[model samples]
Target: MKNTSQSETISIIGAGLVGSLLAVLLAKRGYQVEVYERRPDMRKNTISAGRSINLALANRGIYPLQQAGLMEKVTPILTAMKGRMVHDLEGKQNFQSYGQKVEEVIYSVSRGQLNKICMDAAEETGLVNIHFNQKCESVNFIDKTMTLTDELSNESRQVTFEHIIGTDGSTSAVRDAIHQVNSSQHDIIPLGHSYKELRIPPGKNGEFLIDKNALHIWPRGGYMLIALPNEDASFTVTLFMPNQGEISFENFDTPEKVKDFFKRYFSNVVPLIPDLSQDFFNNPTGKLATIKCSPWHYQDKALILGDAAHAVVPFHGQGMNCGFEDALNLVETIDKYPNDWQTIFSEVEKNRKINGDAIADMAIENYITMRDSVRDEKFLLRNALAFELENRFPDYFCPRYSMVMFHRLPYAEAKSRGSIQEEILMQLTDSARALDDINYSIAEKLIKQKLSRVQLNPN
Candidate 1:
């Protein structure tokens, strides 16, 4: 057996955000790190399909970047978003705070740029090696080897390493190899919804036409549209709609039809998107899915992280955040159980799977909330009451959204707590609505009792 003190070679598949970050962290700790990526260097690329350059980086992702010492390097490139600006069909807007104040801003960053930063940081480490355009063809856990084929040359090569990490993403090749060897059970459930990206370029003289400090949302009962700021003073808009069977763009292909649909449904956003009809015709449709699996690691020889292990919908904006957290958690585990590869891998699998499942479920539920429930009169009333309650009892009656997005609570715990909070708020709202019909004193007592049971002290 090799001595525990000796340096070990670690191979990481996929040079995406998580893989590159993990490579840098491992290399800094004196391990030999090799990263294999199937795509060409993004820095030199002119065009790439199916890649959305912009994403929202909330507190969940920011904390990990700060710990990795890359937050400062990337912060200057981000645009701060303080809240959501909701647009009504009549060209009116309403502001909803995401946090306590204006200074608490989530960042809007370019995903490609962030990936480049991580890749460059990993390369700067003398112990790290990167092979772009090298695709992993197969992996033999019994032999501790991976077969790679050069995409350009069509030549195959073999590499051996002590440990392997997979961050290859939702359609991960490394994940498939691991499943093949371990006979793991996995499922990918596709939501019936599909999305398409549109753009609202800066107005004349390179000025933004809308507020850059807020994420813009236009919810229309059965579907929703959202826009986030870009560094170029533009906005990247996305429209989430039902797939083939439900509402679609087939009948609204012509410019006249598109304009009429926008006029009736999204009058405010229609004017902002100048090339609306062209964008609708040119943009490719994207599918949404949730990936679920158990036992993320296999016998210390191979492991998976990020979207490869669990891919959630983006409604909660936690996909990248959770992936970044996965890297931090794995590194922390490695630090605690140094040189004990098997135990460390086993523990990671157990802990991450539990949290991943929790977040996936939350993300799915958030989709429903965003698409249909956002405009519900009853739900809005409940939200207003909850916020009012928070003002009255700041410590005890925080809203569920505030806790889940603003606090560092565990994903599973947040979901459970949020469910409880919702029940109490619903009862309170119902009682308030029927105040004139029922006995006022009795209703007040019942509301207080429910609040007390949930630890909410509404003074």
Candidate 2:
């Protein structure tokens, strides 16, 4: 199987954010693409809402979209989230800036809308064909064929492919197929926390009820509620809590319990959502998990990307961004080895697996930071010191979150560097209560001794 011919149709399973964007990227390079999606086309259908946690689109995601020329289409749908707006129990609010630079911000976008945009862009290229409602039932690597079943008709058909890429999400059929023949394994690490989505409708004048530029958080140590502003002036609120515990989702079994929980903890949010109980019961509680798989590819015939390969918890807001990076990296790999797909697949897996694992760990850590650490005075002091350190030593020091969100550095490198930076912050802030209380002499010595100057974007 000489898999690199541009004339050969590349079959991509799961016409999701990654797959759809990949189709556009491949089609641009003159390859014909066929995208198989199990769900109906969202543009033409009314898909159920409330399950999707609003995506936080950052620089890593934006760069790929810009490269694909889809940023123009995507920009209008984004709501810039400057930083976390911590909402205390007594209704007091504090804003924490994500970065000192004005440009360092993340945008909140609907997952479905962004997917639709990518799908539309892919179709616009005229070289990509998206077959909606066609579920990929199975893949046969030895035979180079797959079984696609029509969701509406319950009819199955076999389609041969030169190469297949899976972007079908965490519970991927394509990954399962590859697992049968490959020695590599995959793991799904659950965070033991579940989330449910609720909405805060626009005000009477169709204005935002909260600060439109920030992501709101009500961190309660054990459980937390977050809200992101949407394009329609509404806020998409999500509650993350344990699955089974004293203050878990199981405890809020009734409407009264749910409403009472909100009034007690998320008191400020209670007034915004009048039908809180109705929304709580109506929306489903979604699980939070990280999918870690080694060797996201199978020879020259098949590969997997995005959530299908590395699904991280949404705490870091890089799930979509990471998937988009995978798409970009794959396309770039194809560009380098245009005719040898086995090499390309091998290179992608080797390069991406570590980064994927790093982000997974960071996202899980961020869950705790968002739910508990943000409320601590020590945490705030260190966060501020991190920015000041970056200001003082531009090349040598960058905050871990900033590196992940604002730059294209490998997640593995970011995690490694962030670990060293954390040690520096701990030492610098161990005695200091504020920025003025800190000693620059000790900080400079520590940063110089432990860290090396880094290129912001190696891409």
Local distance difference test values of all predictions, in order:
0.79, 0.90
Count of backbone collisions within predicted model 2: 0
Model 1, 75-157: lDDT tens digits are 98899888788887786888877766554567888888888898888888777888999999888888888999999999999
Each model's TM-score, in the order given?
Answer: 0.90, 0.98
Highest TM-score, which number? 2
* Clashing pairs for predicted structure model 1, backbone only: none
Candidate 2 residue pairs in clash (backbone atoms < 3 Å): none
Cα deviation in Å at residue 395, candidate 2?
A: 1.1
Task: Provide the lDDT at 66 for model 1.
Answer: 74
Instruction: Please give, for residues 1-459, the per-residue lDDT of candidate 2 as tens digits.
Output: 123566778899998788899998888888899999999988999886224747799999999899899999999999999999999999999999998888999999988888888888899988999999999989998889899999999999999999999999888999998898988777889889999889999999999999999999999998899999989999999999999988888888999888888888998899899889888998888998898987688999889999999999999998889989999999889888887889999999988889889999999999999999999999999999999999999989999999999999999999999999999999999989899999998899999999989888986
Candidate 2 local lDDT, residue 277: 89
- Scanning candidate 2 in windows of ten residues, the lowest lDDT window is 1-10
